[model samples]
Target: MALQIISVVLFTVFFSEALTLMCYNCNTTTECTQANCSSSCSSMTNHNGNNITFVKKCADSAWCFNSSINLGLIWMSSQCCSSNLCNNATVSENGLSCYTCNDKDCTNRLKCKGGEDHCITATGESLQNTVKGCASKNICDNITLLNNTLPQQHLSSSCCRGNLCNNAQKMTQGPVLLLVPILSLLFYILGLF
Candidate 1:
């Protein structure tokens, strides 16, 4: 009877420990994937099928750019301005562009040239800002001023704790060990009753 009780307790403990380890692995894996996803998306560039150009001077003291594209319906053009003076700017062929200005004077202005398509305009103010202009057949889309920001640092502390992978592994082991003893105690009491 004692042998049977010990075996049952060991089995229950082992099973619970295994389950706890699995849960921890799954949760941490998901967290790691999300962190990676956020990292990747933060660095995403333009998509494709767009042309952007940089303009040195504008009516305002802010930096500006003119983006033009032929999207099969009409030729569209957009002028985007940085809130302040030019600091950093990026233009890409993938229809994604961004500019950063120094202050709040950054304003983005867009216009659809030709075809009587009724000009569209949008504006923004920022310490540093960017703008995206998009055009498609039958529709003219202009993201006058858009902001491209760097990702916030959140994982520094976690990473600083020795190796992140090793820490995660150690954390995962805790839950497994915790569940094992709890399950063993529960099983032992049940067997006693």
Candidate 2:
């Protein structure tokens, strides 16, 4: 009986692994078809000025989260789920907002969408090459995952949870502000002698 129970458990596990989740697959703004995935389903929305595009397909679970990316000229947002046929064309605004960077300007206002609750500031090798936008908390916790969604890699990121909190000036001035009290204390100690 014990041997039979072990065999049944193994069979159940194998059967579950064989079952795949179905997702809606589409690239254009046209009709979508069914696609099978072993992990998760994904829906991605790309916004460029007045134009908006949508893409739906199967994705890996490791990439399953709502995240937004801004690469200067273009901004893309993706939402992922682990249920069958869960990749729908509903990318709603989450009421949070942040700033997006462009080659000419870094003050473009971006409305957070899907599960984006945090503002992200991602910088490349040089501080000059920076991208700021809205992101989900999952992406904030694992900033390296942004490389998968971006055209470029080697980006370090910082996340904040407030309106337009990714402003560059605040981040640059933070270190200088910290030195103020320390410098004052040192001068006071020198004068005491």
In lDDT terms, which candidate is top? 2
Q: Assess the local accuracy of residue 94 in candidate 1 as a C-alpha lDDT between 0 and 100.
A: 39
lDDT of 2 at 22: 89
Task: Give the per-residue lDDT of model 2 (tens digit) for 98-190.
Answer: 887545356777788767788987665522355677767755766544444333434466889998898843223111122222222322332
lDDT of 1 by residue, 25-140 (tens): 11211321211110011111111224322212223212222333321112233333333322123433432222211122222222323222222211222112221222321222
Instruction: Tell me the spans in candidate 1 whose CA falls farther than 4 Å from its real position.
Output: 1-54, 60-67, 71-77, 93-193
Error in Å for residue 146 of model 1? 26
Candidate 1 worst ten-residue window by lDDT: 153-162
lDDT of 2: 0.64
